[model samples]
Target: MKTVKQGDSGEEIAILNNALTQAGYSVKEGMTFTPALRETVVAFQQQRGLEPDGIVGYHTWEALLLGGESEATELADEDFSRGALLLDCETAALRAVQEVESGSRHGFVAPGKPTILFEGHIFWAQLKKRGIDPVQYAAQNGDILYPQWEKGHYRGGLKEYDRLEKARAIDREAADASASWGMFQVMGFNFAACGEKSVASFVAAMQQSARSQLKLFVRFIHQGGMLFALQRKEWATFARLYNGPRYAENRYDVKLAKAYAKYAR
Candidate 1:
């Protein structure tokens, strides 16, 4: 749909007004967009963690329609609370890690698909573990199979799934295990620690909703013995365990600390 802002008028405006009203935002009658409606929209956007531009767009419409339930890609406040309770940490810690790991508040790049980063180095190891020579595939698909981790390889966004599909053709289980999935960026190889019987199950859960992702994160942290570090707000220790020893290179610890402070208020 085209952008709807102040002065626009039509069936769409009527629908937007109705949705805003349903979402508990005050809206005036009729189909014309007015300054009052714009203010209400901006307030709604801010409360929903959306870009508060006072323009009704795809994301704003989606938020208004969803009305705080069944947002598969987003997390509710209660999800964080339950996860924090499980980890014996403040909800702020969980929020901090989530923001740092996913690079934003969202866990999914698209509906039914959680954000993912396919690791070529991990794929090499996974193939080797499964006794399939990565060398055979390396010559043809160097981007998806490499002997060591390097920077600047990520395709980012939906394109990462294309890389994952290539790796999956070689070995489904190994491909699933090579990527980090969802808000927590939990490596799929840690599926067992995340309380999944198989990598496929882990991937399925990751795609389901943010709540499922949080559940997996809680399990992964608790089972991997990282919960205590998180509870104590040991940014360095938590970042090292969660993001690897190279966490300092990207300043994940500092980022986590900052994010935590922002959420903790």
Candidate 2:
């Protein structure tokens, strides 16, 4: 993310605009950071205990992305035990996967928002699946509408919500399906596998808390036919399915094995 101020115009500003709106500040969604938006930013900063400099810098961005939500709700050991029981796997196995998938003890990037990665290429494919040509919107939104999956495009952390907000503007349903959310990193398109009726509902459930995410993860593994592999400690097979065909490129299986070993002890 870059520093955004009055007179600047771009996706960062647009993200700021959306943040302000989500934070309960009345602001129009657009790229230009006008005087009105600045006032809202300053007010938001003040309310959030920031410097109120009217500049959307790092701290301001953090506050806005957090959206005034309270602390993230953590999962208890009993939560993991329940998930393991449902999956017929050892609790350590679930713990290992959770540790590897989220790379954190907690799943949220903000108070209420789950960790997310918006895949632009997936958004393009999802739009096409719905008979919507992503190319038509490519001119103005090249960042979030590419035709092929490409690595390294991730803005990472809360900035991923920026990509998500932009993609949502293009097509909400497809945009929702394009993100991998929460501790287990379940793709929204796998809503049915996670026992959700719709992608929108899946996203809603993901935002609920880490425990909800864990339940969805268990459902996904069971429904997706990966329960046996998980229970048997089949790291290679589980990694191939969970992380995609090129899982070897990042040694996901090896990482999973190492993590599982540590927790199983």
Candidate 3:
């Protein structure tokens, strides 16, 4: 099979963009490469525990190219599983911590402090596996508008209130059963179907979920009737079928299709 190349297409760019964003860098739409972007990419690499060199070489490429679930388990078994694939427990944890802290700024909660620890590494790996592009999704819709902290913890008062309201708005407009979870955010429904009951189980089920979701999505496309209605540009109809045809239009958004489209290619 042929491998994807950099500067290939919008889809490729979207992948890189999503990876960079997940690694804690900001990239605006239609923004081409610049010294600043390169610097940011390098910073992202360093944070991800890849070499700090300002070039997207092997390690950086693997981090960018390898799917989250794949990398996590690969490292779990061996220090360097495949050729040029190396995992440093300390670096991975630090990267996860950085991501959690950055996400917190946007009012999302981190499971814990980002550090070189098994929990943090596992968390980060899960997020990558979820495969939802947070940036593109956020752009088409708006900020996630959800609480980072679990329910019933309102020590922050106004800040918490605002976050709750935003989250309510998002809940009003999105599906209740998303296929994503954790910091790496692997899709929960997909994960469960693939026999994953815990993050620890993800190592065994990761590839299966990835392959299955892709097939499921393709099958949905092939069905071409209900799927067509769901993929429509109109948010109301799309949201309706997203969960149920009459579940109220305010509870789901249709923009996810667009975001997914960018990566599905």
* Model 3 misplaced regions, further than 4 Å: 1-11, 67-265
Poorly placed runs, candidate 2 (over 4 Å):
1-72
lDDT of 1 by residue, 200-247 (tens): 999998888877787778778878978789989999999999888888
When 1 and 2 are scored with TM-score, the better candidate is 1
Ranked candidates (lDDT, high to low):
1, 2, 3
> Highest TM-score: which candidate?
1
Across residues 1-265, which tens digit of lDDT does each residue of candidate 3 receive?
Answer: 0123334344434545666776567875443444665677778766778766666553465556443442221122122121112121122222232233222212112222111111111222333445633343344333222223122323342343343344334342122123232223223333333334543344233233322222222222223233344333444554454334543532333334333344335
Ranking of all candidate structures by their TM-score, best first: 1, 2, 3
**Which candidate do you rate higher for lDDT, 1 or 2?**
1
Winning candidate number (lDDT) = 1
Clashing pairs in 2: none
lDDT of each: 0.84, 0.82, 0.35
Which residue runs does candidate 1 get wrong by more than 4 Å? 1-71
Better of 2 and 3 by TM-score: 2
Candidate 2: clashing residue pairs, number: 0
